[model samples]
Target chain A: MKQILAVDDSMSMRMLLRASLTAAGFKVEEAEDGRAALEWLDNNSPTLVITDINMPRLDGFGLIAELRARDRFRDIPVLVLTTESSPEKKARAREAGATGWIVKPFDPEKLAAAVRRVTH
Target chain B: MLSALATEPRTRRHTIMQGESEVSSDQRMVLSTVLGSCIACCLFDPTLALGGMNHFLLPTPPEGRGEDRGEAERYGIYAMEVLVNAMLTRGASRATMRAHLYGGANLHEGMRAIGSKNAQFARDFLAADRIQLVREDTGGVLARRLELQPASGRVRCRHVAEHVPDGRPAAPPPSSGHVELF
Candidate 1:
């Protein structure tokens, strides 16, 4: 089974996503921020990462930067899931090695499609 | 239904109507309140159970809103930032101060998708910076009352549905479980 990492501070968000992903046959791991995501990464490697941009300890941009710095993680597909729609942030994310962007209150169908494309 | 279900009576209870947030101490209990249409983000330091709630009307002000309308305070971004900052000033860390956001019930009544929009805004704002919403009662054509024990982070949700709009859920808190009241 393909594993997916969902990094966000909201418990509900993780639950919501997990419900959808599980139904689609994907295993999901939850993280609250970039720092936490990093910690989770140290022990496990997920096939895909869906992270939010504004987190307490380490925001998405910072997380991507950290990911890109490591050769081992450089190739992992990262999907930015957030409410921030600024062009500047979007460009920054693309530059930081993000695979794509997914807005919140996400359409599970669309999200599943995105994840499927990147993971496979 | 509210009077009946809530008839059991809370030793102390607060009713935050839609588009309002308040901080108050009554008798021996200090209560902060609000109602959804807007979201009421309740910030509490569980160790201290000390916190405040902000009822932001729009994700941003409704475009042409007046400058002095305190419009700045009625935004999810500002509300989250301010409440967290306030709690921090009182010696709370961003990590420790858990957020309990209420409202954004997609009361899609009449012409306004206000509740849905608010819900999306709340999710985006908090998700941007990984803040977990512990408890939530959103969506439906119901008006909800949120009571937070800032000291313990124990919260109660009372649904008040008399007449309203149609919409989806606007709650952003991580779902632990939920008691559905229709």
Candidate 2:
């Protein structure tokens, strides 16, 4: 099964994403923030990374930048799952090397489709 | 879920709907609401121990929208006014009142973040009314379940995830004419 790392500050959001991704047949891992996500990356490599932008310690942009600067994770796809829809934020995420962006209250099917687009 | 009530059996609970406001001096009454891309303002008078809350879907309704008084409550202006007036009527003094804000989650991506806009409007409205905003938890991608105890002016906010059931394709985004309330 494909492995995916999901990161968000909210527990409910993490639970919801886990449920959706697991139901779609992907093995999912969880992290609470960008810092924790980095720690997870230290020992494990997943097929793709899904993250939220606003967080307490470190953020999605920082995580993407960190991943891009590292040789081992440079080409890995990172999708931003957030509530931010501003054009400025989107452009910033793109410049930081995000693979895709999905807004909050996302449909499970659309999330799966986006995941498939980036991972496969 | 009235889990809070289970712990405190004496607490009275009430759910405030969209475009609605409730005020009371009853120490046992708890007003609650769930928000997604919406805003809820809780106002309280420290001196009088009277408080109220309002849930609004938008900052303003469209031009030439329905003139019914009920329709007006959906806008921030009316919602704030109604909440304040209700509190005042219940012996809350404006000079001694403060506000707390919650909700305003951006539930959808691609579309404009109406939640942010609503949060801004709420701040502006409170400032314009000269009400001090004591606390705020707003503007994110997750939904919130909020409970406000009017008399004690205590509030609890819990983040909740949005669930999209399997086999149910997401519904198409709605147009301005079809604004749905939560």
Candidate 3:
């Protein structure tokens, strides 16, 4: 089973990601916020990570930076799912080593394509 | 400035009309808003006109409940569920209810995290709860002043800012001759 870590501040968002990924044939895990996501990463290394930008404690930028700076997680694919369409945030995310970016309210079809594109 | 104001017809009595008592054979709700950093989402059941809204600030609620049955407190999960459940209690079915969402604004600077989280939060909640989002207008560079008409399931979101998302200071276009049937 290709393990996928879905992280977001909203349980609702995580629910959608889990259902969509599970229906697509991948094992899914959930994280309520960015800090929790990093903690989850410590224990289990998933093939792909899908995260939202705004969170309670540690935001997505912090999570992505932490992941990118580490050699073990450097190769893992990270995708940002957010409502921030601003170019400033997008540029910062790209520089932080994100593999892809998808706007909010994403469909299953779009998610599948992103996963395919990022995951080897 | 006072000379010009004195010439106008001083309208003393502002029109104040109350709405219908929320009644839904199925699930319907009523809600309130608070806090500048937070965005309120009023999810209504189109069939029943019964739903509720929550003012969510950060993405997740303070930890302790641990996704157990007590998760009804998490902003993203709990708040949305509470609104949905409020409608379901009024005899509305979740499957048939069409979600009408409102409120996603950038009220503060570093608060970009909150704005993004709230927008994604609402969208994901509806998707997870198996509810269909009939209409959505979110993530602008302004705060929202909204009112939910339970009778019609119409959520009017007014961008309350001197500027729009495009960096232009403009009032929102008038709401007329437009409908999103999805």
- The fraction of correct interface contacts reproduced by each prediction comes to 0.00, 0.00, 0.06
lDDT of 3 by residue, A1-120 (tens): 888999875566677678778977889999977889888888898999988776657878889999998888997999887645566777888889888777543546557767866775
> Which docking band does candidate 3 fall into?
incorrect
Q: Model 2 chain B, poorest ten-residue lDDT window? A: B173-182
lDDT score of residue A7 within candidate 2: 90
lDDT of 2 by residue, B13-73 (tens): 9888777778987988998888877789999887887788888888876654523334545
DockQ of 2: 0.01
Best by DockQ: 3
Q: How many backbone clashes does candidate 1 have?
A: 20
- Give candidate 2's iRMS in Å, 1 decimal: 14.4
After best superposition, candidate 3 residue A97: deviation in angstroms?
0.7
Model 1 misses residue A39 by how many Å? 2.0
TM-score for each of the candidates:
0.50, 0.51, 0.46
For model 1, residues A34-63, the per-residue Cα lDDT tens digits are: 899999899898999988777667889999
- Count of clashes in candidate 3: 9
lDDT, ranked from best to worst: 2, 1, 3
Cα miss at A11, model 1 (Å)?
A: 1.6
Model 1 CAPRI rating: incorrect
Clashes of each: 20, 2, 9
